[model samples]
Target: MTKPNLLPRSSDMASETSAEFSWPPLESNPEVFTEYLYQLGLPSDWFVGEVFGLDDDSLGFVPRPAVAVIVTFESLKKETDAVAAAKVDFFMKQSPKLDYACGVIACIHSVLNSLDSITLVENSILEKYYRATKTQSPADRATTLENMTEFQEVHTSYASLGQSSVPTAEDDVKHHFVTFVQNALGQLIELDGLKKGPVVVNAASSDILKDTAAVIQARIEAGVYSDSLAVLTLAKVADDIDAAVQALIDSSNGVLEVTSVENKDGAKVSRIKCTATGHEMPPRADIVTAHVNSKRFKKATEWYSYDFAQFEPYIVSHRRKPKCLFCNVTGIVLNKIPSEVEKHMQGRKFVRMKEHVKFFDEAEIDKDD
Candidate 1:
């Protein structure tokens, strides 16, 4: 649907730019788009993922209730009659929403038009752009985009994430992006900055992604693009993982704590711990799940304190993980406990290490280094 989220067109608005600017082409990658959007205030619960194909089977792989579908296709030369070509109408007439930032444009088009599914983060660079240009013309919006340093900086940063050689400002990029989003009325609408206006891809739709796939498939059959095209969709991938983890912490009843500490590699890591027991482990729901549902921990302390205490000199912590000195010296996993210690102690390697007094402590090595 034509929303005021983009620049409002005007009769006398200037379209001329004193200086030209071009955005680097972005790769049609879901991971890259997902990360890029995340940096731009896309809610953590939502993510962009690659659409394997336009066929029904392939589209089925996408998360259900797909909010929008974007295509990376060739931006062909503007035909003299392209605007009037294959024109179709709906119950009413038309209305709205630029740049090598065709990728950025498509990203913006898909997001702003799909407000029902996406709420741009408050005060985010994208939100500022949406608010600033809702009443400007496409040309004016282009000029605004070129001048918005913060937003332009973000676009430029992600442009380099493209898989191929980064295109320079002077280079002509071949790949272009377009978005297909369903308006409020469930009508399939096409948003291309290069187009005269929003093109209604379909009059009606039960499923946005499925209908989008049909439209793209039709375009493919008509030989619209010379090269293979890539498709990506925005969807609700999962519950916000961080939020889930936070909820877990809130309900942990002082049994669990998540702390950020730098490891030997100098990377910040969230180390999960059982505060009451002074035990630490990775921050994963399934680990918490298995413990609550299983009896494995019923004798856990006894396993460590009573039976495993004899190997105290052989125990050490590495990379925030408690490991058997004998095992790390031998290159292995996984954890501490007396039964496991006894099992490894019977090994010939353990016997050899014990016989000659050959012992190694990675924790000590790291400290020395």
Candidate 2:
């Protein structure tokens, strides 16, 4: 079957007049923005997560210690004063060619500045932009960004909202997207595309997420969104959760290297050693158990009810030869029915296979859906 387009589609905002065109408005979704970042060559370790509502409690949904928060808020007359009164570190103003795309770029710029782990590839478009504008004035930096064709292309492509073709101009909308971040000194900064400089929210704390939310909340209460708070959407740029989990699994691979130290009377003396540190490494069995208990593992087995209906024919055709669902190698026999399969399931090989299957299944499900 031809799978449906799993990509996000933009709302009907085609231009009424043919003379002018604007970039399509992007969805304020973490997954959509995250995938776009990946398309821009961001490493898998980083992603964007959306905060559903502007409520203080809603901040808990996003990963903590987020590199930056992308906030979509209604533009108001007092916005300039509100941001100025707060602690502000404004960046360059948005270029005319990249009007709507700047907020997304500013969010990414915050991540690049705050998070050391979210590094760009060597000689990357982002790297070049960073280096070129690192010492330039905000105006110069903005000019430098406007000329970066590759970066603009990727941003525009994602901004297309999965349309096979898009209009030159989008319906003129009033809402604006801005980025909130706590700099290295622990001061909240707002980066808006429309603004000439970053707005500093006069709040400083180690927990930037909550503090930034409070700032946005304050703005909402005083600005146009005060009446309708749902207009505010937040996305956190942070390290990927799955990648962090996988790193734990990888760290468990501290080799127990054996080396012969000396020979005594033609007998060799050896010792086994592990050189890895930073955290107490779990045993292989514990790692396997963790994998089995993961959500990915549970979801992959949805198609497998263990009624043996799907496997009975395959099992019989192979003459009782049972292959591990995880390992894919067949050595265990299906001679004894469910008991044999159940017994095989406890083995490490099956556990390893389950881990692999879970990863594959999750990827397939994500891609298909």
Model 1: what TM-score?
A: 0.57
Candidate of highest lDDT = 1
Tens-digit per-residue lDDT, 204-227, candidate 2: 666667776677677666764543
**Which residue runs does candidate 1 get wrong by more than 4 Å?**
1-22, 75-99, 240-369
Where does candidate 2 stray beyond 4 Å?
1-24, 80-90, 115-117, 162-167, 226-369
lDDT of each: 0.62, 0.51
lDDT of 1 by residue, 236-285 (tens): 64322355456666876655677765543365666567653566543444
List TM-score per model, in order: 0.57, 0.53
Model 1: how far residue 84 lies from native, Å: 8.3
Candidate 2 displacement at residue 362 in angstroms: 39
